[model samples]
Target: MALRISKKYIHPPVSFLNNHFQFLEISEKITRSKIQSLLDEAYESRINNLSRSIGLAEEALSLSKESADKSFIGKSLSHLSLFHMIIGDFDLSINMANEAIENFEDLDDAKGIADAKYTIAGALYKTNDFSKGLTHLIDCLATYKKLEDYHNLARVQKSIGTIYEFFGDIKSATQSYEEAIDSGKKAGDLNLQSNAFNPLSGLYLNQNKIPKALAIIEESIVIKEKTEDIRGLAFALYGRGKVYTQTKQFEQAEQDFLQSIKIHEEMGEKLGWAMSHHKLGALYIKMNRLEEAREILVRALEYSNKNKIILIKFKANLLLHEIAKKEKNYELALKYLTQYVEEKESVINDRTAKVIEGYDVISKMQALELEANAQREKADIIEKKKIELDSFFYRISHDLKGPITSLMSLNYVAKLEVKDEAALKFLSEYDAQANRLNNILDGLLRLTKMSFNEDSKQEIDFEKIIYDCIASYKFLANYELVEFKINIDSKIVYEAEWALVNTIIQNLIENGIKYARIEDGNKPYISISINQEGDVIKITATDNGIGMDEKTIDNIFVMFFRANRKIEGTGLGLHILKRAIERLNGEISAKSKLGEGTTFTVVLPK
Candidate 1:
């Protein structure tokens, strides 16, 4: 007989605030301090005394509004939203979050807006609004990445992974979890790490990677224990119980589930406590302990019904139905089966309604598109304005370059003529400033040219272009200390605009070398790999260098974004690379860990 492993596990929404007590500076210090203290109390007692926590958050909100401090008001609303979600008041949570977002936006607070969105996303998840939840999560991910907030980034990534897993996109889910793990490690937050680990283990288990699943879940359990995260430990133990049940270690599975239940009951986590009881009952049924299974299943059913946990309620009824049949109680089996079917249909209907709601949104969007089609004249006018803007940039870039070049030439002559150390120093500074301006103008010119020019397609010589890129960077400091490893398939030749391809490859290599760590005993190396799979060309550039934090990686492709201040750069290399790839309808992504290294991957069509 095939092993039947239960896949129903509770993944609670992350309820912790990103910046709970870190309030912005306001004129009213006394009010601000009072609000902060109230929020601190709310967060501390959130689990143990939920009603008190809610009261404290409400008090903070009232105090914040009285102070007329928008930042404090937003923070208070965000905390209240989180507290609401913890108690399963999802609609209230979402309403509070939306209000918080409005307040944050009025102040142009990106972090505040993101924090509120994160809370909204969690609430949306509980409400089964996965589409909206995923959208909010993606937005939160971008803000967290740009802020280089690793702790929140990890949390967002894990949430994204869960959504992807729900959609049955295992590959994307796995990638998201892996990214979460990376960010969690970078943040040095063991609790965050365990959050990712638990879900990741479940994914592995789904794939029948039993040993791998067991190992990761155990690792999470250890971290949760060490961190004294009683809530997290309960979840971890519940997950481990599932793993043990799958492995046919029934006694170990029972023990883990019982411990999880004890913890959940102590913490007053009704949903988790009930879920653990249901799972333990299921295990008993598997072991043919019919009487034990029947007892626990009935208890689980009552708790689930009281909590309105529809999923668990239906599942427990089904288990009871099976136990009744085993005892040859036909009438009782029929009754339980009827309840199971009715409850299960209710769940299906709810999910169906949600799907229909999504379709309704799409239908509205299509109607909007049709309305937009009637405004072609306005679109044409906007296009013309865009063209004019491009022309202005192109002209200005050229216009500025001449003066910049002249300034540089004059500075060079002044350096040659000036004999005094002070005068030479002044000339050197002038020269550097001139060069920086020149580089900026050059970047502007390239950007404008990309906007106007047509693609000049040619067979890309990956090897020669890579070699040229490295040689051009030879003048950079510590260039001699870097090792370049290039690997390209001899049979692969991608047909694309040479300049675009070169731009992508060169910037990646330059970024690696420029940021290469020069500390004693550190051997910096750049590895470039290129290959073609079917119609897509894949290029990866990796470097063991002074890697970036999450924020830098997110903004790396933005115009004039500089990650390293010490390195002499135009801050336009990666931006140009991104633009060039976009021009070719290609995609680019980066992953990095501070003090470890970075890897850039580009996927382009042939």
Candidate 2:
């Protein structure tokens, strides 16, 4: 018999009303206050008093509609949507969310629309409309990113990760989880951070990385505890309990599961309580506590059946069959076995129907994607011509470099030999122009070479490569005066194309050095940090230098777009760096202030 552990963990959809409430203005102050208070009460009581929460949200909705405040109506509807979702009324949730979206759109509220979409996505996922859920999630993700709403970004990412995990796309799931954690940190929301941490730890545990899994879950537990997120803590404890179970710490596992069940019961979360009891019963079976296992498994089946949780119901039946067989009750064992098989078949049939529906959605998406791809093919033809143009430029730049080198050498010799002051001054100017041309040609050569070169992966010695980059910039002005702080673990193993990685690292270091502030009594510095997280390599370079304004920062990666003209650059460094990162299928971003400095972050897959 194949046993499957339940992966259905809860991550409550965030309340849209709270975030957008300040933006709303109602003519009737008393009505606005009343609606707002009801919404607040609903949100607060969601986990512990779901019915009450739903009642409060409905009351808010009625009040908002009577007051003719479209924004408040939208918020109230969104709240009701979330409340319905918590109780597994997914269809109702989706309906409410759609109505909320309509009201928000009427009010021209972007945040409200996005938040409602998120709630709809959550409901869609619960209803096994995976493709629709994903589409809505993508929309929500884009809106949140554009708004720079890191909290919502993290929430969306975590949901995306969960969907990917459900579909067996572990790699995409891992990346999404990492992104969620990063966004959560940026948002400074500990609860959101821990929410991502819980699922991420499960992924690690699935890979049998026990130590990493344990550490991650422990960190999540700490954060959840600190925030007094009781529901979140219950989930984290359940996760840690699984880790303990895997490591054969039966006693600890049992205690953890019991604690989780206790929390679930207190919070009046029937689903969580059922799931925790099922897990504890499984643990008891593993520990040979047959009687105890049988009792809890029966209770688990009762709750799951009552709630229509088919997955858990079937699983509990299977365990009960095992308990009956062990106790030598052959007839009872046969009955339990038959029930388990029937329920398992039902689950398979239900899953098959959902999968078919999912495939239909995917087929439609693919049709749209195919149309998009046809357009992309036309674009690719133009791109190919551009590549040819770049090839021609590459050859021209390469040929010009030799002559520029010769011209520079001749200029140097002439400067030494020239007798007249006027002639020598002209020679110096000519030399400067020639050198500038040479630098431009060099930059072009590197850029075009990257465009044409085939990617070849090799083990990256980050320590050596970074130091080499720093060493090359020693002759730059203020290079000696600027402090370099490097933090990299020598043991990190990353593999990528050598040239692309070198280009990314070199340009960032050179930018830091070239733009270093040279004021007396001020210490200019650059900090470089590299670390590997799973299959991704993250490199961050920070500098307290002559930073660019917002407009300049926006255009920094454009070819020949100079930020600081006095600094004497080909203006191709950042452009080339960005191209190199793109060539390697990585991401690069910059954050800066006019005076404070800039930090460039590059993320690459290993």
Candidate 3:
């Protein structure tokens, strides 16, 4: 996110994710502790790993939000928030969601806000705050509806339906899921339909409608395959295996369960793998294959305990205890059951802790955003004040230029009309003084224009412009008969503000003329050159001049800082030149020897 955490970053599309499920795959390969940690990341949604494909996503999101990365912030922040949701940290999820919610206004990024809303609603649903969550969820639905984002809308509806199913609101749940399935069909999004089909199939299975449940789940597997939804396919396979187990179709049930396990192993979905093992254990028990059942159940218990997944632990505990009870190891059975309850309670306590943490995070982020917005407002006020002050100064100086120049020029013309020799000398001195006033006014006007000019940009030939400026000034420049040279290969072009460049060049030349040496025996010279190196273009104006001390050179760029007030007139040229060069994304620096020469070089991007 930007400072407000409400700016945008570009995000990877869901289509990018549609290709595979890395979370499940990582689960299969790593050690139990590592796999558990990865799940914690996925659940906490904070784990960043490359081998863990989901971490690839977090890395991308993080890159977008760092510093003022406006380009990708919108995408990353909300993605991280969704990560929080997937892991069940509802408060953190909500905090991220709310931060993302205002991104649409930062830019006209409706899709960004929509994604944030979706994440927010999901968090709310996860934490059992269904009412307010539904509002955001519904708002997201409406946004997606307008966008015609059928693929995403279907997912949201399906999630809502799943929650309803969890709450035992069968009718509403079925309708909502059905709507999602229908929407998915229209959108050609088989993933959403496959997701919706789970609850539908699960509902039927629980009611003992074996054939209907089997048919729906089989269809879900087909859709999951079509969509390349490996995770959904694995779950669907599990569902089908359960149906087979219940129907006493032992051979088909074994085939389905084993197939599910193979896929889970490949995908590294620990939860899926654990479920597969638990089911295998149950099926073995049914067959009175006690030894095989015990082996698989024990492994399942190990994974469940490591992951701190209470539900899995509970199921594994019941199976292990029953196995013990059947063996007449009553004490062992009781002990396993006791451990199961304890593990289950621990998982619940952890979830409760996360909920509290999430709330605090949300509150803190909201406060930070509010403060940042206040600072932004203050910054805007300061900028406005600066603009107004500059505008007033520019307007007054601009209005004075024409009259001042006219008056000075008239005095120059009157000097030429003087006839008497002594009077002519006096008039000529007056002319020089008037010309000084004219130079001052001209410099002032250029400074004012450079400060206030607001015009469109164009690609400029920097080399040509500098050469032409030198040519225009060559004759009028009243320096001693200095050896003036132009040493420039002028093919470089750059994006620039034209008037600004002209003013900059004009000022650099004027400064060169004003400072050039004037002595009977001294070599007085000024040279102009331009060069390009990669993306940068450089211009150098060199002069064998009566140069300033290092201290004066340092102060020269400051507005109205003159090395010699006796030289007369305004000292704003270098300041104006600096501003002009900066505006065109160029830089200027001076290298000089006081009794030898000065080289003023300007560098700009091409």
Backbone clash pairs for candidate 2 read none
Residue 574 of model 1 has an lDDT of: 88
User: What is the model-wide C-alpha lDDT for candidate 3?
Assistant: 0.72
**Deviation in angstroms for 237 in model 3?**
14
TM-score per candidate, in order? 0.53, 0.54, 0.47
Which segments of model 1 are wrong by more than 4 Å? 1-27, 37-59, 349-606
How many clashes show up in model 3? 14
**Tens digits of per-residue lDDT for model 2, 157-183:** 999888778677799799999999999
Worst 10 residues of 3 by lDDT: 42-51
Using lDDT as the measure, the top candidate is 2
State candidate 2's TM-score. 0.54
